[model samples]
Target: MAKWKLYWVESDGYEDCFVVAKNSRSARSVEANMNGFDISDATAIRVMDIPDIFEEKADKKFRDWSKIHAPQQANNPDLHEWPWYADKWLLEELGAQFRVIDNEEQILLRDIVYAKKPTGEWYTYSIGARAIYERNKDLPQYDNYDNEPRIDISKQLYTAMGLALTQCHEIEFLFSNSFVFAVSEKQKKKYKTFNDFFKGWEKKTLGGLFSAMQEAFDIDPEVKMALDLFLDMRNTLVHGITTTERYDINTDWGQKELLAFLDLFLSLCDPIKDIATSCFEVSIEIANTYLLKESDENIPIKSSNELLSLFINCFKLKSMN
Candidate 1:
């Protein structure tokens, strides 16, 4: 199967998607997509493959996030729902909208096939990636992440998880997890059990996403205690177990710990990407067997329940064939 080592998609800005999608001008349309400001009013569409390095930064973060849990919708096609999935920007807002006044026809964003208009003068840029119906037998490789702390965490996550006793202390409570009894003690009273304290890490991040005192950190007893608690919190959040939070923090605040969590998650997935991807395929087969109709049209491509699927899909990314 063909791969997008480097690519972009664009629209012809037409109301009739099928036709205009096949016929927008390349140079001008691409210019509009790149530079938000317009030099000319002529309708345009394009995806200029700037130097491969240009997309590296965004792709690096995206692939890392995808490996961790970002389901591939258009981006993470394999994963299920994320908290952000409900946002309108990434979904159907597939590409930036612009007025296609020239001779554009179709509106679907898929591929950039160069097709001329019926009037003989204008040609439009097509938008979207065209994939083969069959799954790609080969693996996908993208830009690599070069962050020091994140990369180190990724390397450490799996080994640390396995050797839990030394690598990480599974403290029952975050508030009482740390040796700093004075500070965490007052916090502990609010949580009856250590698990309850853990429940609040995601919720509590919002409370201190910017504060000085940390809830989790590298090799810190307090951080370990806090993380142990958070793992249970994540479990409860997923399994529908009853939970009350005295401390509520954002699960992801884009902080060092969050980056570390991402690194560790991705590192752990590195071993499972292939197995996970295959298992995901098997699950889809099981799903298809129970579906109302098995045809492509009837198959649901995106769903609110695919978060688990997405997580599994990440297991397949950057894996051994």
Candidate 2:
């Protein structure tokens, strides 16, 4: 038989209340679960109570917030007095728009996953809710940050994004696209400040995009030669060049080339964040384009593949026209 436990951690201390669910998860699996939940230190176990796990950055913030505010609240200490668990849970309406997840009670996004599957063939998911909670005022500031895996290069990109709000120097982006990105070294001379770096991002992006594509795909000499020619003529900015000395910041062929690379690279990267972002975009487009007021009553299916298909079909149709 498997055992499960649900305990709540607070400034006042721990309590055995909600039974979240505890099973014989393997050490590796348990560790992964802990990482995902942002639970660095584990103690009591159970099933029913939502995991109080939180990002390291946000963890201390929540603890302090709890101490000052509702120290007696039996709910998650991080959310102490915020009605976040109650009012603003995410839910998809008929038109794929979002509403409160479960009535007016507080709920975690993960807890309602299985139940939130789309009513049709395809579905969409968003980590944005997580991003939103991390930034929203209702939740304790620290409840939103996860900092342990700062060494993971891939996730480091996101960690940098989270830390961006705090002005913490974890990762610095040379460029930011829908899902594609390139990070710069701390000692590098490419950018002077956060604002300066991002301001000139689109210009630097094409070089990175071209490089990413050339690496991912084995392009023929003819295609590669042609691409190089066009890139130089239209978008010939160098990626490694990180100086404000005299760089052009125009929406030239470089931006277009880089955007192309981003489109292709995202396909390979499988960035759930971008996919989820696009899913919401598609949902809103569908609602505004086809369905209107009745959109809220309809649950449409919009998957990454479907979005790609729509993109291709629209291109084909436009070419035909």
lDDT of model 1 at residue 38?
56
- Name model 1 segments beyond 4 Å from true: 1-36, 39-176, 183-321
| Best-performing candidate as measured by TM-score | 1
TM-score of 2: 0.17
TM-score of each: 0.20, 0.17
C-alpha lDDT of candidate 2 relative to the true structure: 0.32
Candidate 2, residues 97-202: lDDT per residue as tens digits? 2333323222223211111223322122223223334334585533222221222232433343233322211111211332122132321256776456545554
